[model samples]
Target: MALKYSNKINKIRTFALSLIFIGIAIMYVGIFFKQSMIVMSLLMIIGCLATLSSAAVYAWIGLLSTKAVQVTCPNCSKVTKMLGRVDACMYCREPLTLDPNLEGKEFNENYNRKKQPVNKEN
Candidate 1:
């Protein structure tokens, strides 16, 4: 499949981690603006907001984890959590789907999008 996919939880975790790093970097930049009280304060506020947002994201992930389906990956035989109709194995990166109709089909993120029924007039 041309589509590149990764575990949903893993992806969100990565984002949360990156947000933390970004927050630290932003705060560090604030140090350079020490001569300007307004600029430094602004930078610090932005950094704090970034860090706080990451914490919220992490909390949201915890909530999602509770709802995710736990399944054993056949390819790796490892237990993994899936978020939607299809997701990749957390350990082995094996693609998995809860829907049988999607089995062996090309992996597409668009499959997750809601499809509208087409109207036909005879």
Candidate 2:
């Protein structure tokens, strides 16, 4: 079966969530090395860094969300946020686009990177 893509924000949120879990797991594993203070400290530090990085990712997503266009998904009839010229519905995974030229065409992520009259420099 082919893989399904999720909304960019949702994907990033999932990643951050996973990182929190991974950090906790690493800290738990460190308990096994109680005899080695240096190893235990290193493991704890790594775990803390993972969680801190996850927090940063969450903050970044929040900033991106402000720039995302809010639209009602026709497929699901629900309000959702889109990040670029094209995106998928967060609820139904239905493809959506803001460009009139792209309507009725196959959804391609490259459409976001395609050169256009408007400048959207990062």
Candidate 3:
């Protein structure tokens, strides 16, 4: 089985976008309990928080994006921003790497991790 990879920046942006819709859905549901002022208010508050959190996420990603390195993808020949040592091309989803040692090696997200998991053998 092959694992599909997506650009980290795009993935975070998608999550933030979904949060907005989820917040709107929550607020819409609050309309059903109009009779209960407390319930309605609580739902509205939670919904607003969700929406605000998404904004924060957007801002954070924006900051990270500014720091990301820009590179032209070999497969797509289009410019894209990438974080860490390994990431997929935003436009083509082609695996990319900065380290010469990792070139031609199988793409693994673990390359970005600070610590490698111990392999236990019996």
- lDDT, candidates in the order shown: 0.89, 0.88, 0.92
How much is the lDDT of residue 121 in candidate 1?
50
Clash number for candidate 1: 0
Candidate 1 worst ten-residue window by lDDT: 113-122
Better of 2 and 3 by lDDT: 3
User: Model 1 residue 25 lDDT?
Assistant: 95
Predicted structure 1, TM vs. truth: 0.90
Tell me each candidate's TM-score. Answer: 0.90, 0.86, 0.92
Higher-TM-score candidate of 1 and 2: 1
Better of 2 and 3 by TM-score: 3
**Regions of candidate 2 where Cα sits further than 4 Å from its true position:** 1-3, 114-122
lDDT of 1 by residue, 1-122 (tens): 44446999999999999999999999999999999999999999999999999999999999999999999999889999998888898988888899898899767656666782343652
- Candidate numbers, best lDDT first, in rank order: 3, 1, 2
To one decimal, what is the Cα RMSD in angstroms of model 2 from the true structure?
A: 5.1
